[model samples]
Target: MKKANVAINKDLCKKCAICVHFCPKEVFTIDQDGYPLISRLDKCTGCRLCFLRCPDFALEVETELDD
Candidate 1:
């Protein structure tokens, strides 16, 4: 399976848990400040739903290439 990396931009994030709720893989969790955090990166399926649904463009999903 392909590996995925999740990136969150704190500056752009508005603490709206949209990414956390939209992710089918449940890869994100809300922090104390209400920011999204990568909680289960290993379960990520490289789906861009979180990235595309983000209102602030703060979340990103990147597929990692195997060497």
Candidate 2:
């Protein structure tokens, strides 16, 4: 199965929680410091919902091919 590698740029992130709220698979969770955390990476569908929704352009989603 194809998987995704999600990267969050802390310097660009504004802690808007858009990615946290927009993730369909609940792959992200807001940490105590209000940063988005990839809590359920295995559940990520690579749909790019969070990446597209981030206002700060802080999120990146790259599909990983199985060998």
Q: Estimate TM-scores for all models.
A: 0.90, 0.91
- Local distance difference test scores for all models: 0.88, 0.91
Clashing pairs for predicted structure model 1, backbone only: none
How many residue pairs clash per model?
0, 0
lDDT of 1 by residue, 1-67 (tens): 7788889999999988988898898988998888888889999989789899999988878897655
lDDT of 2 by residue, 1-67 (tens): 7789999999999998988887889999999999999999999989988888888889999998775
Model 2 stretches astray by more than 4 angstroms:
none
